[model samples]
Target: MSDNSQSAAALVQRYYDAFNAGDVPGMLACLSEDVAHDVNQGGRRTGKALFGEFCAHMERCYREQLTDIVVMPSADGRRAAAEFTVNGTYLSDDDGLPPATGQTYCLPAGTFFDIADGKITRVTTHYNLQDWIAQVTGTGA
Candidate 1:
């Protein structure tokens, strides 16, 4: 990989590190002011304020950590992708998901990022919602 690509990978790695540490401010620091977030199986939200709101809501509903992370950056350093495992516990009821009862779950998830000027401009996350629902509901294999 090129130097720029390595830098992109480092930026993504730092983002995940901040996420694992539950450092919302650190995570936001890696993002551009006008960051765009594409939530898993959900609509897109733009800007740091909205992103912070989303993070707040997530904090209220769940406690999570990412592990087994692997980041891959594009050659030009403009894009990157990461795969990781999410270990989490449902803490409270979310808007449309199942009710929470402190149920713990492990799920594989991935994210794509768009980077520019050393800041993440866009973040898109993906995971299997149905699988998560089943696991939390005691109905999955």
Candidate 2:
């Protein structure tokens, strides 16, 4: 484990910490200016500004926290991966999803990151949409 790997791991840890604390500024501080985000079960969105917009939208529609987070960095410090459980409540209606009734769900999720110059350049998140929908809608889907 090189020093750089440790730094990368720390950066990722801080990012999650910021997320848990609902500090959007702190989370953005960990990302590069042109950071790219591959949203869970969705398309790619780039740049910190766009990321902030995405965050705002998420904030409007859902209240979420990540639990049991584990971050693993590559030996070279250019890549990392994280696994966690998303504890969330659907707060408002979102397009292409079941209506929100303040439903609570716990979903397992993962994310991969690309780091450079002590900042995250890319983030790709993964999770099961159907499972989440089923849980939220109570349809056992």
Candidate 3:
């Protein structure tokens, strides 16, 4: 891979590492000052403050463990797709839902990241909501 591609991959890796470690500051350091992050399970967040809020929310709701992180470099070498599973235990309220039963939940998710100048400028994440609801609520249809 080219240098740019390698750099992008590294950034993606750093993001995941920070997430798994629950190091919000480290995660933000890997992002641009004006980042645009879209969490399908949560909501859209722009800039550092909003991103920090999102991170805090996640840290509170789940203890995230990243698994199977596959980073596919984009043709332009400025972006990549990261697919992984987050195995976590619900520890706090989620989306107005009550706290989970303290059972472990595994969620497969993907994030498309845009990197520029060695920092992540954008990130769009995809995940299943119904499964999360069922896991948190301990009931299903």
Weakest 10 consecutive residues, lDDT, candidate 2?
Answer: 132-141
User: Residue 5 of model 3: what lDDT?
Assistant: 86
The C-alpha stretches of model 3 lying farther than 4 A from their native spots are: none
Q: Model 2: residues >4 Å from true position, as ranges?
A: none
For candidate 1, write residues 21-57 as lDDT tens digits.
Answer: 9899999999999999999999999999999999999
Query: What are the lDDT scores of the predictions, listed in order?
Result: 0.96, 0.96, 0.85
Point out where model 1 deviates above 4 Å: none
**What TM-score quantifies how close candidate 2 is to the native fold?**
0.98
Model 2's lDDT to the true fold?
0.96
Clashing pairs for predicted structure model 2, backbone only: none
Q: In order, what is each prediction's RMSD in angstroms?
A: 0.7, 0.7, 1.7
Higher-TM-score candidate among 2 and 3? 2
Q: Residue 40 of model 3: what lDDT?
A: 90
TM-score of candidate 3 versus the correct structure, residues matched by position: 0.90
